[model samples]
Target: MADVKVAVKILSELKSFVMQVASQEVVLDCFRRSNRDFTRNRKLPFDRLVLLIAKLCKKTLSIELEQFFKELGLENGCSVSAFTQQRIKLKASFFHWWNQVLWQSYYHYSGESTKRWKGLRVIAVDGSNISLLNTPALTKHFGGQSNSHGNFTQAKTFYYYDVLNELVLYPRIEPYRYGEVQMAYEGISQLSADMLVIYDRYFCSYKMFALHLWAEQPIPFIIRGNENQRMVKEFITSGKRSEIVQLAPTCPAIASLKKSGFIITPKTLLEVRLIRVELEKTVEVLVTNLTEANGYSDDQFKELYFLRWGVETNISVQKNIMQLESFSGLTVESVEQDFYATVFMANLHSVLIKDAQSTVNQLSKHKKYPMKVNRNKSFGKLKTSLVSLFIEHQPEQILLILHGHFIRDTLPVRKNRTFARIRKNKPGRSKHRTYSNYKPAC
Candidate 1:
């Protein structure tokens, strides 16, 4: 099938990049013992360790070390201690670089322009909290939130999600005390002039707007405005659909900008456009740098603002489908490793499923209700076939197996579905159980 060939080509290209990274001396040095000779005793090479960790990330159930190695076809595999030691030495940057490589490769080969909106890649920004095991190191590094029930360790996760491509650009995990807006400010550095970033009202601040302008090549952004904010109130009172307003920097904003190497005075003001849209129940205000002269109209802004919901669904996929909260290790190092590994695995799945999705859409055309691939089933298949896809000499055969399994099951989409928001109380930490005993209904 055409889908099978596409999947094979994508995986082959990914494997080639992974091989190139593995051959780098800097990457190989990370796995070597400090005192060991670089030329000799290369027991667990960079590629093997990377494959091992990636396979672990894809599993639904926790796998022990010996069984994992045996599954990898290593009868005389290294000890569990050796793997752990090597994993510790493998810095988080390795996975970051790996993700960048895959993204660039996908961008080059996939001809993905259909996913873009009006010649712009729409990136959504948002933050969520990820629950972690209550260990001393985890609690110390990630911190926790306390309720009447008790305290549970949690980490703040920030995502720069590409809505059109179904890919995550930058995923950062920080201490629970770190504010979401602060993370958003730091994330601005990743943007380019061509990107159009969208944010929820929580990130609407003068400093955020200033940081975007301070970029080497400033990028465009759209952010929801808090209804109660003074600027929103003024804009609503003006009785205009859209307007460009000058915002004077606050003292704190000036200080923050100055510290970041921008010497701006408090009197300096930033000009941004404000657009108002009326919904069924209430009016929504959005702030953006997009202008009417650029062919960005008020009607277009309404639809573009709703695109932010894609990031919300993306987060749900990470938490509910990928089991991001169910960490495998108690240490902070292991937690970081699992976090980035899961992100990498998610992107890999996106790349593999890209071509198959079109085929799925075609198959659903005859049905009364349109359908899409059941992500749960596809992820399950990926978990079982991933190691073989990587290690087996004939990857085409494995890719075919994956394509056949993935396209078999599809779920109907219910259009215009709406549900009332439910606020559930947080259960106490006393109800927590070991991850091994817990099974998620995917």
Candidate 2:
């Protein structure tokens, strides 16, 4: 188990990094210029406003503006309209840079071995849709899904998740009409040779595969095969466990590569290995660049593919546990701010629980089943204590409180648990109005 003192030190480092960014001269100057009351004193400073937004993002329940400002110690709190104006003045880039800073600091402090898989960082790529409030601004910016009942606004979110570390390396939001494949291609630009990307069948295409291979470092990837594809069909018919096949680029793929400064001709064929695995009801095909000669065997591919499920669970945590679909504001800027802030808090929560989690695992070794920290409980405790960790003079007291609560409540891990998938249709709202004529029975 990791030492509590070490964990405290890491938290202190994170606090220092946040303070450095918030207190930068350039950042302060930018805020001063943005504020209408630059010459007059105000209750809400730039750093305070940023911290307040961060706390709101982590809060489990919706907080009214009056109560929120009262908790911040503003006796005569600013009005809702004034607060909205202040929030609009702040740029979303501030949160973006802060998240980047936090990510880089985490990588520096946390050892590389903690996040690496066989000397490579394993990353998974997937996209999900976040439901937004039915507002005209939201509909105009993010679009919406249509049904027979009505139209509901939604925003498409693409994530590049670190499967081993349980962290979102990058997240992008676009309109609902945006294609996942296009967003995925944009995500590929962030890859490096030291990383191994895993993808679902939806991302399996000639252009996608070629783009990765053509990178300067040539990122290694494993993508589930689409059975209808010609190469995949041929490999499956051959009944070979593994074989190398040549993929001919399409005209559009060739043009894309040429535009990206890669010299390729019509005769150029890219070599990729195809691995065939038989499951209970179907034969699964995987296309990857890793080879047997390089020490990657057929058995290892199954385990590697299973790791991709971590990203799916990560999305579940965001949507269900964090309540990511609940927006604090209706504007596009506010939506973007909330999105990045949620990601930052998620990463922060992971960092804070590392030591407690290790301790719990060690203590559970003699029990009937292995136990893990209850995430919902830990998140709640963290939310209650988040502001104190930053603003209080003695922050170690708050950290100790968080550590104690996190180690107390733990859930047992039940391995090999399976259940039939649930399929349910979306529920529609009732058309009848209840507010005008309804009365309480009492």
Candidate 3:
């Protein structure tokens, strides 16, 4: 079990980092829309506003405003309109950089026990659609799909999730017109050789594979390939569990690469290994560069490929449990702020529970099903405690109280539980719609 003192130290470091960032006038200026924003002392200052957004505002704006100040032990709070005015002054990228510093601190202070698979950090790359308020400004900024009825406003999100650590390394919200593959390709600059990234079949492309291999430090990746593809079809028919093949870029792949300053001709072959994994209902082909025959065996590919599902589960949590689509403001800047702030808070919640999870594991080792902290409930507990955790002079007491709550309510992890996916036909209106007036009933 990790020492409770370690978690305490990490929490201290994170709070200090926040204080440091908020204190620097030069740093605050970079996140402001104009030089004059947040220059004067108003009801809401720069640091207070940053913490307010990180609180995961899912309630009515007015009520949330009142409660946020109340939590801080202050009787007075600003109005919703004032909050709206102040939030826009701050750029959304502030939360992005804030989350970057947060996870970096976690990895740094959490020590060497950070989870990895075969000495490599198993990072999963995936994308999901986020429902946004149907307004002219939002719709114009982020285009969405149309139907017989009308168009729905939405945005596409690409994420780099560290599945093992349950941290979102990068959370990006792009215009709905952008393809997931395009976003993934653009995100290649963030990848490192130490991480083994997993992708779904939608990300399978000749150019995508070449980009990883051509990086300054080649990144390792596993991409699920469509069975109908020529190479995959031939390999499937060969009946070999695994085989190394030379993949030649298609004309379109060549064109895309050439435009990106990576000149690849038709004869430019990318040597990749293809593995066949048998699922309960069917066999899936996985394209990868982990071709060492002994290092990663053909039999291990199935479980490694299955690890990609972690990202899918994480996305579901963001949508369902985290209420990620729940925006506090209507503008694009607010949307980005809410998105990145949620990522930061979620990562913090995950890290804070590590010690408690260890305690739960030790206590429930004899139980039939493996027990873990209930994340949905834990998030609520964390939300209420977040202010005190940062502001209290003695945060160790707050940490101890949080640790107790985390382990007190536990959920069982039932392995190999599968359910049929119910695919419903699209209705006249999107089943997933974000209302301008409704607040989440948490």
Best by TM-score: 3
Q: For each candidate, what is the lDDT?
A: 0.77, 0.76, 0.85
Ten residues in sequence with the least summed lDDT for candidate 1: 433-442
Q: Write the per-residue lDDT of candidate 3 for residues 235-327, one digit (tens) a residue.
A: 988998989999898999999998889877788999999999888888889999997664988888888888888888888777777789878
Candidate 1 ranges with C-alpha deviation above 4 Å = 1-10, 30-44, 57-67, 76-79, 112-114, 423-442
Candidate 3 residue 297 C-alpha distance from true site, Å: 0.9
Error of 3 at 284 (Å): 0.8
| TM-score of every prediction relative to native | 0.90, 0.89, 0.95
Q: Which regions of candidate 2 are displaced past 4 Å?
A: 1-18, 25-40, 57-76, 259-263, 428-442
Local accuracy of candidate 1 as per-residue lDDT tens digits, 218-262: 789999999888999999888899999999988888888777778
- The global Cα lDDT (0 to 1) of model 2 is 0.76
List the candidates ranked by TM-score, beginning with the highest: 3, 1, 2
Q: Looking at model 2, how many pairs of residues clash?
A: 0
Q: Which runs in model 3 stand beyond 4 Å of their true positions?
A: 1-3, 423-441
Comparing 2 and 3 by TM-score, which wins? 3
Q: What is the lDDT, from 0 to 100, of the residue 85 in candidate 2?
A: 68
